[model samples]
Target: MAAPVPPPTEPDASARICPGDQIGPCAACHRPTHKYGRGARSPLCEYCDAKAVERLGRKLRAD
Candidate 1:
């Protein structure tokens, strides 16, 4: 009688953080960011996005 061979084992890959989309530069700050949908314009970085909101508030107050 012949014995069966065991399957090869591999290290766990789930622990690794992988981005499904490509990482590109942020439009406003040029920092590394995960790109969104295809054909979509680049988005602002975190700091720029927050600053935009603050600027909008200041503009409204000035009106």
Candidate 2:
């Protein structure tokens, strides 16, 4: 038998944004996003960033 999978967890508040951060539209989703750390370079919203990380993780695990 296999174990049940856990539900996806939400990113922490710190992952969302920080003080004095810039806001802009996401390059991929065109939604408003806060520019923080590397996110400033990619301009991807938190949702899109999470999706992208999940996709990359799956691809890496498959290889």
Candidate 3:
């Protein structure tokens, strides 16, 4: 058997606190707010976050 290598980890990823920011299988539909400071939190891709939030807000208002 051969030794296995750990998956690559992004620097500062430990502070990641978003949903949509997660990529690949871990990617989610939404991300959390960036509180504390810019570097303290994880930022989702602008496009994904904006669209999701817009749609969600519209749905809620409609209801």
Expressed as tens digits, the lDDT of each residue in 1-63 for candidate 3 is 944422334322323554444333213323332333333433443444445677786454323
Tens digits of lDDT, candidate 1, 12-36: 1221232545555667656555455
In order of appearance, the predictions have TM-scores of 0.48, 0.46, 0.24
The window of 10 residues in a row where model 2 has the poorest summed lDDT is: 4-13
The residue pairs that clash in candidate 1, if any, are: none
lDDT of 1: 0.48
The candidate with the higher TM-score, 1 or 3, is 1
Q: Encode model 2's per-residue lDDT on 1-63: one tens digit a residue.
A: 844422224333343565535655566665655665544665656566667778786454323
Each prediction's Cα lDDT score? 0.48, 0.54, 0.38
**Number of the predicted model whose TM-score against the real structure is largest:** 1
Candidate 3 RMSD computed on C-alpha atoms after optimal superposition onto the true structure: 12.3
**lDDT of model 3 at position 21:** 44
Off by over 4 Å in 1: 1-20, 57-63
